[model samples]
Target: MLTIDITGAEVLGQQGFHRDGLSLSGGLIMDAPVGRAVDLTGFRVLPGIVDVHGDGFERHLAPRRGAMKQMAEGLVAAEAELAANGITTGVLAQFVSWEGGLRGMDFADQVFGAIRDTAGGLVTDLRPQLRFETHLLDDYAGLPARIAEWGVSYVVFNDHLPHARLAEGRKPPRLVGQALKAQRNPEVHFQMLLDLHARRAEVPAALDSLCATLADMGVQMGSHDDHTAEARAAWRARGVKVSEFPETLEAAEAADAAGDVVILGAPNLVRGGSHKGNVSALDVVSMGMADAVASDYHYPSPRRAALMLARSGVLDFAAAWALVSAGPARALGLRDRGVLQAGKRADLVALDAADRVAMTVSGGRVSYLSGDIAARLVA
Candidate 1:
């Protein structure tokens, strides 16, 4: 193992003559003297990104309409892309919905199997996170065992059932179209929603039971796209502390006030807005409402988003970088990595001027480097 030292990088937004050298030995930072001999004159070293929610692999898995890559090939490709984007640790958000289709249980099984068979062996540490739709209660029983077997670190619950308020005045045609797009038969989906509403009182109890079960099985829970303080509070009460993609500023604020880590998508920050027409992540960061950001879909967004947030004066480099690095790592309960601190794992990335990943070091090994990775994989 190489004992390398990174010299002269500023530490986490602190100013004035703050130059430190990180020593890496045996794939982890070792306690050693900052030798004056090493030369790192102009480079800025940041921790390797820990992306808590990434769905880009879904695209790669089904690259085009009616096309799908083989599971192993997709996993390899995803790992390479993640390393190329400076993401050392990534949670692949497997969307498990009740409406059976591409994003449903069968797809989840393929993904979970791929992840289980090829986790630590991959270039980047790929973890599976089931993005469970709350209405998919029937799938919950099998999930706990899979989580335990695979060592899934995160679970996010999403309820995208059309709001009762929105449904009241909507035309049937429009509702049908929306339901079909969500991969549900229009009548079945509509009936399911109505049935769900009728059993609303039991919904929370069922969700809470599932949450407790998952927690008991040692999986961290997160709530996704929470739209209200009440919704946020309900999730927090269920011991789901990580709030993923709050749909409104108020919801994000509530999560922050409750001391829950608020995760926004890096794509939102990079694009300057939300794709779902939710709260602007830049605005959220400006208001100090977001604790972390993840590459929710696009793999490159996290690094670029961090730089964008820093350059736009929304946050300093350290604080912005934390959103992609330490913040997500901490949220996932990963203490071994995510910081350039003395005892952390030597998972680091070197970026070029455009904030593109030039090289990625995972666990003290050079896993990917600029053209080298793309060259090896693409051929």
Candidate 2:
């Protein structure tokens, strides 16, 4: 297709929503109209959702909790779902954790490799995030090299070791099933967890070294589910600048004080509180500390959360919507999309007056088009 003049829609432009038509040619937004036009009357155009942290792709990759034999097809299917949700760019947050099955390092290898090879051909930009277990001391030395080899730039540190249970010399609940899924001997896996717990005291130093090396390599780093000011401070010292879903007001406040990007789950925003009963995302947003809202597990929440924020009067439409688009793009240092301006990537979502996504375009390609708007564009 040549340059398309997207007319008669309330496009969220640099200055906010306007009826001025948008044009895209050569996979980028254009200053002026140059080709055929479509009247998207009663529709709203906004920057495509940039999912900062999401792992919903796991369903596509392992619907039954087992790896799909055809990884590439799974990724393509995942892209379709993303585009349908108005996600022009999605960060597939994969785990390299002690937990077995799809989250293990070996599966991370497969997932990252597939993303690197398959994402280039897809319309929706798929980014890879490595969620590493901070207490996995054995994996520290080669982590940077492995990240580079996997072509992944974003890494989040997490400590999900169930320390209290292990310290009590108890097997964590569902231990046997988890080990079975990972194809590990249950007793051996329990021993491994115990050993990892014993080394909890060493994580700080190990993370300090590993994160420094990753920072030197320009890899974006984040700390996950922080619960205290001290914990957030510790991560900041290690060059981790993004606090992913801080679990307390103290942690979120600490991150804000240190100039770190604080990401909250969109589900929390929609539900009015964290599902895990931690800090409320709305409370954090009300305090002006949240940098972005992400689709942590459900792909639809970012859009809904932004709309909800707008309706709740915490922010105007543009500002609320930016939480899903520009804010996330900024968190990942992606400058191409998020804002609908001339010379930027023409990534946007067109929604009906009812707020249903009618069409989605990524880099000038129509990744998704449906409803009456399809006829308008075609006609």
Candidate 3:
């Protein structure tokens, strides 16, 4: 691992920023100086981002039809994007949905396998999260075995079947587009969706069973797009403690009341509200109903969201940044990183005077470096 004594920068610690130098050696932060010293005078060093929920890697994993033949190389590229954005710990959310194409089981198999096999050669801690469609009752039986086989410990349940529209016997607005993406005939796809929707009554028991099985296997479980307190409670009863992007204040407050982790989308914060017309992340965070902010679908939103939150005076810099760092780390059950402390993994980002990501270091190894900071590290 690369070792260095970094001095003069505004290093963020448990309390706040300090001018005291930071040291790294053998993939761990050191209590004192080690190896060559580097003067990072005008920079601000912050803990590496730990994105607990993100599907942004989907683009890199399969940019277009037949675009990513070599999946491992694609993962490397994904890690590079993560490193560039100061994310050392990134959870690449893949779906086991009926949507097919990138979100289909076959593609998910390749993605989870590639992450398990390829991330060892990459710097970022690329973990896999399987987003399983809740209405897939038939697939629930073998879900645990498949999850273990894929080496995925984190699973989130999503129900995106357009239940209301289907129940009304209305053709979903995007039916044709969804069929094209899945490469199934439109009528066939509609029928398949209707079939899944018709079995909605059976989903609850199936999910309860699946979540119990996963919990026994020591897997982490979450629910996506929770819209009501009752829905949040239902998930909580299954030992699914993380609620990602609760679409209503009722759901978010329910999570808070139950001591469950509430994750809001960073993109929502960046956009000033939920683009989908749901509850605002800022509102939830302001009321202390949210615990973490995730990238959701955009890799850069977490960093921007934190900075914007700080500037808005909703929180101090440390607390706001923690939503992206320490907060997510806690949600992911990772204790070794997320903070700049001796004996912890040496994961940190150096921001220039302009707050640009000048460099990112993961496990004491330089993952991304650019601008004038590169010359200083080399000197």
TM-score of 2: 0.98
lDDT of 3 by residue, 104-152 (tens): 8889889988998998888888899999999878888888999999899
Model 3 misplaced regions, further than 4 Å: none
Top-lDDT structure, candidate number? 3
TM-score order of candidates, best first? Answer: 3, 2, 1
For residues 1-379, write the lDDT of model 1, one tens digit per residue: 4466666543342221246666778888777953333344444567899998999988667675347657777788888889988898988998887545557677778788888887768868888998888876666677678777656768889886665642573334466766775677787777776665555566788888889998787788999988999999999999999889999999999999999999999999899899879999889999987878999889999999988888887877788788899889888889888888777888888664455676687888777776433343233
Better of 1 and 3 by lDDT: 3
Report lDDT (CA) for all predictions: 0.78, 0.91, 0.91
Give a tens-digit lDDT track for model 2, residues 214-281.
98999999999999999898889889999999999999999998899999999999998877899999
User: Alpha-carbon error at 174 in model 2, in Å?
Assistant: 1.9
Model 1 score (lDDT): 0.78
